[model samples]
Target: MTALPRRGFLTLAGALALGVTGCQLSDPRITGGPTAPPPRPTPTPVPDIPGLEAALRHESDLAALGKQALAAADRLQLGAGQRAALGWMSRDHGVHLTALLAPHPAERPTSPPTPGPRFTPRPEPTSSATLAAAARDGAIRDLTGRLDAALVDYRASARGSRGQMALLWGSLAAYARAAQVALVRDAPRPDPLVVPVRELEPWSDAEAEQQVLRQMHALVYGYQAAIPWFRRPESQTAYDLLVHWRDLRDRVTRLLRDRGQTAPAAEAAYALPVQPTDRNTAAELLWRMEAAFIPFAGAWLAAATEDESRRMAAEALEEAARLCLEWGGPMTTWPGWPG
Candidate 1:
C-alpha cells in the first residue's frame, strides 16, 4: 500500500501530538522536490521540559547501575544459555527504559467516536499509587518483569514475523511500564481517549501505509535516542545536520525497499506542483506546528492532579521523548526535514 500523502500524515500526527485538531497546514511554497544531502547533527538544545536535566541525571545513574548488574551476572559464569538469556533480558530492560524515557512523537489518532456510541469510563485511582509513590525508585524495577516476559515471547517467535511482532509487543510492554513509572513519578494522566471528535476511519491501504510510516518513524526515533546531544546551532551546522538526516531517511527507506518493502508515500498535497519561492517558510510552518504539538501534550499530561494523570504523563513522555530523540538522529526515515 502506498503511504498516506505527507501533509495528511502530518495532519493526523499533529492531531495526535496535540491530542486535538484535524486541519491540514500545507504551505504554498512546497515544490514536491527531493534533495540529497549528508546526515548532520543538530546542536542539542537544552530541553524545556520541567526538571529535564535532573531527570536525565537520574536516568543515567539507573542505566549505569543496571549495566553493572548485568556485567556482574556475566562475570559469575552463569550457564551460557542462561547468561545469553539474561543478557537479552537486560538489553530488553534497557530498551524498554529508553523507550519510556523517549517516546514516539507521531501519533495515530483513534477511530472517531460513533454517533451515540457507548464509552466506559475508567475507575478512580487505586491504592497502588500510594504504594508506588512511596517506592518510586523500585517501581521501574518491578515493571521490568512485564517487559521480560514480553521480550521472551518476542524472542521465541518465528523469525519472519518476529521483527514486526517484537516491535508491537515490545512497544506496548514498554509503554505500559512507562505508564507505571509515570504514575509513581506524579505526572498527569489524562484519559487516553480525550479527543473531542471521533477518529476518521481510513481505507485498508491507508492502514498498511500507516504501519510503514510508523516503522520509518521508529528508525528516526531510534537515531534521535542514540546520538549525543548537540548544543550549537550555527547555520552551517544546522544545514549540515539537516542534510545528514535527510539522507539517512532516504538510505534507510532504500534498504527497506531492497528487503521488499515499499517506502512511505510523500506528503503530496503539501508539496507544490511546481517550483515556487519561500519554501523555507513552508518547512518552518510544519516544524513549528510539530513543535507546538509536543509541548501541548506535555502540558496536558502535566496538568492532572490525580494519580492516574501523573502516571499516564510519565509513561507518555517516556515514549514521546524517546521517539523525538530517534527522529533527531542522522538515520531517521523521513526524507524532507531534519527533525
Candidate 2:
C-alpha cells in the first residue's frame, strides 16, 4: 500500500468539500513544515497489551449502553435530531468496538459500515418544563456522559499504550468527546464523512507530536491575519484567540523540549490555505486552521504518554472541535475529524 502523507489526515478532502480550503502540507506559510520526511514507514505495534484488553472491556460496556438507550429511543420522546444522536453514539461505539474486537489491524474491518449521524446543532428546547417532562431524558444524558468517561480512560491508557493500539485509543477518545458535545447540545453536525477508513497504518508518534506543534505555529499566524477582518467584538475575540494560540504555540514548543526534541524556529509567514478576502473567508480560515490539526492530534495523544503531553493533546482535540464551531465551522458527528 502507498504511504500516508505527513498531513493527508484522512479527512482533508471532506473539509474542502465544506467550502474550507484544504491545506498543502508542503506550504510553509509559517515555520514552513519541516522538509517532507520520507514516506511514513511501517510502525512497530507495541502498545500496552493489557491496557488493550481493559479498553476492549470498557468499549464493550459503552457499546451496550448505547445499544440499550437506542433500543428504547422511540419511547424516550426524543426528537428526530435527538434520536439521531442516540443512534450516532450507539453506532460509533459499535464501530469502535468492532475494530477493537480484531486483535490486529490485519483483521480490522475493511468496509466502513454505517456509523449513524454525528451530532448536529439542534436548537435545544428553551423551556425547562419540556425537558423535565421527558421520561428518559436522564438516561440519554447518562449515555452521553459515558462518552466523557471513554475519553478519560482512553487518555489514561494511552500513557501505557504504544503504536497502533495507542493511536486507536486516541481516535476513540476524540470521537466519544465530540459526540458527547453534540448530544449534550447540538454542535455543528458535519455531513457524512468522505474520508475512507482504510487500513490502520499510523504516523510515527514523535512525528505526529511535532507536526501538531508546527500546525499550532501556522494557526497562530492565521489567527493574527484574521483579527483585522472582524468587527469590534469579533475582532477582540480573534485577537484574544490569537494570543491564546500564540501562548499554546510556545507551550507546545516547551512540550517538545521536555520530550527531548527541539522545536524548529518559527517562519516569517506560513502558507495560507485560503487567503482571507473578506470577513467570511477570514473566519473560514480560522476554523479550518483549528479543525485541521485534530486528526493527527489524536496520533499525538497516542504517542504522548506524559501527563502534560496527553492533557495538551486531549484538550487540543476537544478545543479544536469547539473552536471550529465557535469560529463558524459546521458541527459534525465527528467533531475533530473533518469527515
Candidate 3:
C-alpha cells in the first residue's frame, strides 16, 4: 500500500476575555467602597495525552482522503447506492476529524499558530474497475493500517485522560475500526468466496429474531468457556468480556420474550470456531464469536420495528465492534450490514 503523505492544516482556537472595573462612591455617607467580589475559582487543567496531536492529524488526513474518494466516485458515475454509502462514510470521517480537532478545556494556545497543508485531490478515474482497483490497492489498505496505528494512539491517550475525554478517545478508536471495515467492504476483492453470497442475505423478521436467539445462546456458551481464563485477578479484559456477554444474553432473552417467543436454552457445549489452547487463543476465539454475531445484530437492526428493539440492536453492534478491537481483531467496515 502507498503511504499517505502528511498534509498540514491550521489548528485554530477560540478565546474568551473578561474585564472588570471598580468605581469609587461619590457620597462620603457610603460606609465603604463597594466590597470587591469574591475571586472566581480556576478550573483544573486537563493533562495532555502524548501523541494525541499526531493522531488527530492522521485522522484529518483520512477524512481528506475520504472526500477525495467520494469525489472520484462521483466523477466515475458509480451506482447510486455505492455513491450514497461512500458519501456517508466520508461525512462520518469529517465528523470524527472535527471531534478530534475541537479544543479541549485543558489545551493552551500556541503563540505562533501552526498552519497545516491540505490534501491534493487526484484526478477522477475513467472506469469503475479503475476506481475499485484504487480502493482495493490503495485507500482501503492505507485506512486499515492507519486505523491500527490510530487505535494504538487512542488507547494511549485514554490511559492518560480523565473523565469524558478518556471515554471519547476510546470510542473514537472503535469508530476508526468500523470505518476501516466500511472501506474494505467498498473495495474490490480478487478471490471467490467459499461461502455462498445468498447465505449472507438479510433474513425476514422472524428469521432474524431466531438467528439472534441462536447467536445469544452460542455467545453464552462461549463466554462460559472464556470465564475460567478471565478469572485471574489481573484479567480486567476477561472480566469485562464476561460481563458484556452475560448482559447481551439477558438482553436477547428479554427481546425474545417481548416477541412472544421463548429464548432457546443454552447448549451443554457449543462448537468453537477454533479450539483454544491458552489464554491468547481463548481471547482470539471469543473475538471470532463476537465477529460472527455482527451479522445477526445487523439483521436484527434491520428487521426490528420498535424503537427499543432497534436501539438494542444498535447497542449490540457497537459493543461487538468494541470487543473485536479489544481482542485484536481486524477492523470490520460494516458490522451491521447483512452482507
Q: Name the best candidate (by TM-score).
A: 2
Q: What's the lDDT for candidate 1?
A: 0.32
Better of 1 and 3 by lDDT: 3
lDDT of 3 by residue, 1-339 (tens): 111111011111222233545666864564667698678677445445566565656556665655666677645445444444455555545444444443441222212122223222222222221223254345456546766777777656645554334334544555666555545544322111122111234455556666777777777677667766654652666767667777877877777787788676666666677566678767777767776776666556556655566556656766776665466454433344332
TM-score of each: 0.28, 0.62, 0.45
1-339: candidate 1 lDDT, tens digit per residue: 122223222211112222345556674564556676557666434233232233233323333433443455434333443333333333333333332233221122223222222221212222321213123235335435433443344323211122222222323333333333332232222212122322223223223333334333433332232223333343334355445445644653564476576666443233222121243332332232222223222332323233333333333333433333222211111111112
Please give the clash total of every predicted structure, in order. Answer: 39, 14, 8
Candidate 1 residue spans exceeding 4 A from truth:
1-134, 144-171, 180-186, 194-248, 256-339
Which has the better TM-score: candidate 1, or candidate 2? 2
Off by over 4 Å in 2: 1-9, 12-48, 51-84, 105-140, 198-206, 225-241, 255-262, 270-284, 302-311, 325-339
Rank ordering of all candidates by lDDT, starting from the highest: 2, 3, 1
**Total backbone collisions, model 1:** 39
Lowest-lDDT window of 10 residues in candidate 3?
Answer: 2-11
Supply the global lDDT for candidate 3: 0.54
